[model samples]
Target chain A: MKLIDRARMKSPWVLHYNSGSCNGCDIEIFACMTPMYDLERFGIVNVGNPKHADVLLVTGPVTYRGARVLRNLYEQMPSPKAVVAVGTCACSGGVFRNCYNCIGGVDKVIPVDVYVPGCAAKPEAIIEGVLMAVERMSEHTPLKRGK
Target chain B: MAVKTILPFGPQHPVLPEPIQLRITLEDENIGQVLPALGYVHRGIEKAGENNDYPLNVFLVERICGICSATHGLAYCLAVERLLGIEPPPRANYLRVVWAELHRLHSHLLWWGLLADAFGFESLFMQIWRVREMVMDVLEKTAGNRVIISVNAIGGVRRDLSEEQISEMLHTLEECEKQLYALLPVMLNDYTVKKRTAGKGVLTSEQALRLGVVGPTLRASGVAQDLRMTGYAAYGELGFEPIVEQGGDCYARAVVRARECFQTIELVRRALQQLPDGDILTKPRGNPNGKAIVRVEAPRGELMYFVVGNGTKNLERMRVRTPTLANVPALLEMLPGAEFADIPVITLSIDPCISCTER
Candidate 1:
């Protein structure tokens, strides 16, 4: 009911991270920003800095070296944040399950709120994942600042 | 004088969405030395290829770089097919060309869009990607998926084009060609884009040749080398010619790709028009028992695949060489002595795909 919560529901800036993808899911995420899919219609904008973002859209199976960076990005975000794991690799390590470098799935490094499953998750499915993250954000109380 | 500083770019930079970190040392706003850090997106797909069955590796290699995935799939399939001593049907080879060229069309469009965004030309970025969706739609309609179509199989193609699909695809290409013509001129000749890209990352023909820069990077430097000219798959019959640019700068590289988009559309249209009538697939009988190597022209440049099989379903070894790997050293050579702010433009000029590199 507060002003911040109302604004949060109206718009959610999302951060996308490619821990160890083949770039399939990453390009689809990029497509969501383009004219055709246009995630802007839903008020979902892709941000670079983790601190200013509300929803973290993580793609790819977490690789050994990328794990540390992945953890760092997730921790930098403010409270009441949601992580959406995009693609089959990020969800459950689609084909790279046996690769020694990949620990497999975004959840291995961080808790995932929603999993959009595809080899390369389509823009439509990725939009659905962001919407799902927004819905979950409405359920939580916006964290009090300057605690 | 600006103070000397060490700046690490990416693994999470706004301009570069993919994972690649550039360690640039700056002296008074001019870059002194540059180093690239990798291993962020390494999935060890080469080893996975050795473990995965020969047929299944088609899908595995497709994941190497989603932008140019079909070329990866085609090269892998071609290598294994050679080892097995079976040729794909004639019609299948033509279909392979169709899909590969379509992938190139979309991949270059994506690169142009990203390059425009890198220099903060937001509307051009949006406009380029919008035209790109027409190619994506045709890919999805024919190959049954957008980015990684997976239409290619070991012996031949897994999908077939019906009468309606062929007609629809041609209509889409006509519209796409029209839209691409309207937008690409802005990227090629506009003063603002020229200021940002022209002469920004000039790699002389000698430097590009010595560095073994492949694809548009090489063509931009006025070298006439394209793997497609070597005539693998249906390219021999298609009579393909490489697009060449003499500038060897970021603008020249962009021009090569811009022209390549039109060439790709023509190749696809010709292949579809000359569509041979027959089965799209043929099954190989015996397991692969020798070593074979195949090189194909990916959207970025040359994509090579080496496979060794010992009369078994599992490959003894599978090695891949992506074009980005060939272009990086040349990129390192281009970085020093350039303005620090031009880093993103110069870095993207090579169209670096670290995932393909580390794999």
Candidate 2:
């Protein structure tokens, strides 16, 4: 029972959500799964369900319409989940910060544990962010959403 | 009497990654109506374009669609250059074609892999993406970043290709093309692939013209109207022709893209062979002033950029009409009669880029 958190990190299923990204970070995140990057070798599977996810990878500046969906996705994930804001936009709204529809970064909608910063956040950075998220997620008490 | 069920297919879905909800009304397992609800990724980039300095807008527009950012950057540069009345040097023109073709090759490969994934062809998907990685490597080797290389500058490309880089790129392209051919039997001739894509979501040439569809979608429907024919950049000198397939169905669209991959490879080879030896940049004296409308062939279709400058750093108005936006109507037309099971496959067939559409 004590090792459950550690066990969870061993094989974490990731859920990727694109709130309002330009598809830059999202593609890099997807590229992580390809043969060259081979993220699956680490036992990280990109899942579609929020319930099955141990970590959430979000890309883009949260737009007004996407903010609700972002919050909804975060709230639905089981406790002890970690959110990694991938890309400059998700970390701090990047270039889309001043755009009319943008509501700023992912932190505005959900508690982000790690920030993977890049215009398109390279696949290496995204993989590191997910791993960092795994460590951070394990540190959570399993009772609360964020510490 | 058949009862209709309304189902929302993403702002978040497994098959199509980016968020664009489709309100699908199903009647007895067949899709009745699919109204695409697309406000999720709308960051108001057109408005943002007007706010940014003309030089900076190149980067901003590139972010509009990461998959084809290089093409987007090229189009924006072409537009602004026209406004400034200064042409990029000859070497810059040839280099632009090389990178743009590489961009198209990768984008089509990505779409090809995604289509395979959409139809549950897992191993095929992985194989195609593996080949795509070679293109990414070339882009990184010559330019720097993988996806958004930002090689494009105001008057010319930022990076120049070395002879070593050119030979290495050609070697990679040769290997990639061979791998693509090995996969072609399964992608085209395989019964399963055909079952999923053949005669599905067909848009006849007339309907295609009426819908104002662009890119492979139009080419699939037998319309040979690629903006590249108008010969922007180095396409004129390269003697390019649109890859047209007459099937006009989902399979045709897939075939158009598949055939286009080979054409793009040849284009890159030709452009590299004819690469002019000269300075790449021709420095612009002052801020751009006047109106310029430029359209270039993006991976998806025709990407149009209209910039109106007032002799200032910031443009008075910058309007971008992305290929995906033009193709959405064609997608809407194709969805009404498709089975629920085929929705994902049909959607993938168009290679829809919701980010580009909404941006």
Candidate 3:
């Protein structure tokens, strides 16, 4: 079980979803994977489909239409998954909190395990976010293994 | 018997950060037609600007679109400054140029990463973004905020760069240019990338002009037009002809941007060397009463701002003409003949920011 936990911590494949964001955080999040910050050294890969993903990196202030898409995608991911809400918009609705279209922060639609806050959080912060999410995921699974 | 097939490209597609829906009419995976429906994240920020005081409106406008936030703030300040007849210090003008080009680099690096993702060149996406981070770090160090630098004000910018800071920024940008230049050839001449992009979504010089595509899109189509040439800010002091490419395809657009990235680094370094000394801002004496139209080059394209201040605290009306919105009709024209699998890749060529457009 510890081995599974370690492997998940080491090689968590991510599926990023934007609930409707300004491109600031979205671009910063991508910057995390670029050559300088290179998250691949941690063995993280951004997979296209949610079903094969282990972590969900969400950005933006979830809008009304985005809420439906978010739930549909969240449901598609297999079990044993964690959601990391990146950027201020995803965490507390940021500047768009009172906008006509926003449906509040991501937590309104799904359970979020970790929150990284910034108008657009930096790449360094996003890397820290993925690691923190894995730590929280470990505490949730029970200690005893069934025979 | 015919069945209407539906495919949802994004709210989470690799090529874009904002949620945009394109319902494609497909005949067995061959795209028969495409329809785009935006307004997913419309914040009604334009209306918000009308309510907020002039000072507060500056902050609100910066959130209009994250990628072009600084430019939005710049255009708004310019419009308001014109109304008040305040010429910021000479140093402020040069400082604005430095930050604006830096913003251009960050924004273009972002667009480059998305372009790589659209083509499924994930590693390249990562590579470009890594370089992009250095520019953001520069922004943070200088402006004290990463995305919304909030550097520009109606009178002038708030922060000033010391000689040491200026030298450090110059050094940092030099390294970035070297690293980015090393990667440009592969992105331009790589076999697979060219095969995918070269002829796809061909917009000839004439077609681009007809559609009124601005910025790199127009430049790629061989139009020698750039609002920067209009001598706004200190651009006239550091002169260069427009970067033009003849092909007008996805490949040409990519070339135009790659070249501009290098040019921007040159511009920033030059501005630093020629950095003038003076006051940053001067308080305006009277109320703003007239409407004004201010145009500037945003990272994506030509960004124009229209503001009508009614001699009071609030603006009578405010309008933003975003580049993505102007280029949409052009993108719609490019989509019809493209292969079904290339829809996302081709659509992304315009660097769509639905939030910016819908605002």
Best by DockQ: 2
Q: Which lDDT tens digits does candidate 2 get at residues B25-76?
A: 9998999988989889999999999998888888899999999999999999
Off by over 4 Å in 2: A2-6, A142-147
* Residue B294 shift from truth in candidate 1, angstroms: 0.8
Ten consecutive residues with minimal summed lDDT in candidate 1 chain A?
A138-147
- C-alpha root-mean-square deviation, candidate 1: 2.0
What are the root-mean-square deviations of the candidates from the true structure over C-alphas? Answer: 2.0, 1.9, 2.5
For residue B255, give model 3's deviation from the true position in Å: 0.8
Residue pairs clashing in model 2 are: B215-B301
Name the better of 1 and 3 by TM-score.
Answer: 1
Q: How do the candidates rank by DockQ, highest first?
A: 2, 1, 3
**Candidate 1 has which clashing residue pairs, if any?**
none
Per-residue lDDT tens digits for candidate 1, residues A1-147, read 478877887789999889988888899999999999999988888889999999999888889999999899999998779999999999998899999899999888899999999978999999999999888877776433323
Give TM per candidate.
0.98, 0.97, 0.93
Compose the digit string of candidate 1's lDDT tens values, residues B93-178: 99999999999999999999999999999999999999999899999988888898999999999999998999999999999999
* lDDT of each residue in A28-86, candidate 3, tens digit only: 77667777777889899888788888899998888888888889888999767899999
Model 2, residue B170: C-alpha shift (Å):
1.0
Give each prediction's DockQ, rounded to 2 decimals. 0.84, 0.85, 0.56
Interface CA root-mean-square deviation for model 2 = 0.7
